[model samples]
Target: MRRPVESAQYTSGQYARFARDHGVRLSVGRKGQCWDNAVAESFFATIKTELLDRQSWPTKALAHKAIFEYVEGWYNTRRRHSSLGYLSPAAYEATQETATERAVA
Candidate 1:
């Protein structure tokens, strides 16, 4: 017997096939699970608050450039995060790398 495919299921299946074919890993989360992407959600909120809310961008390219600089130059390198005990992402990564090296030695 042939079962009917719902539109949402069919769309998701097609996307999953596309992702698999392209070697892209898609994040899986339950329909109502908020915490599954809590980190990403928090990051988005922070970026919106720290960058996007402060100014108006005339073009997408300008916005993209600004966001790139903010993330690479400011956020990762200089901004202190509360979750990481006030260490910048670069500093936290350095500490983590050091710990890994110590563990391997």
Candidate 2:
């Protein structure tokens, strides 16, 4: 079942507000862009396999904390991704920043 359009719009608007407050550049692409969704699907799949499927959470609060720790502690800082030249997300981002700074200089 699909969500009501009004509810979807409300959620999207809330996300846009949150993104703006966080200085996030939201990627608005034309419809039918498989590439845009693929990355997120891959991440969700990996997280499901690694964290969600491994154990059960007694409480939503605990689950949220675990998810936060998994992403921040291990996934971003240490997990090597093939698409990122086998570098962790944090390392890849750092390199990208350095490259951008050098190009600007």
Model 2, position 62, has a per-residue lDDT of 96
Clashing pairs in 1: none
Instruction: Pick out the ten consecutive residues of candidate 1 with the lowest summed lDDT.
Output: 3-12
Q: What's the TM-score of each model vs. the native?
A: 0.75, 0.70
lDDT of 2 by residue, 69-95 (tens): 999999999999988999999999999
Alpha-carbon lDDT of model 1: 0.86
Candidate 2 collision pairs: none
Per-residue lDDT tens digits for candidate 1, residues 1-105, read 996663665237788899899998877665556776786788899999999989999999999999999999999999998879999999999999999999999
Whole-model lDDT per candidate: 0.86, 0.87
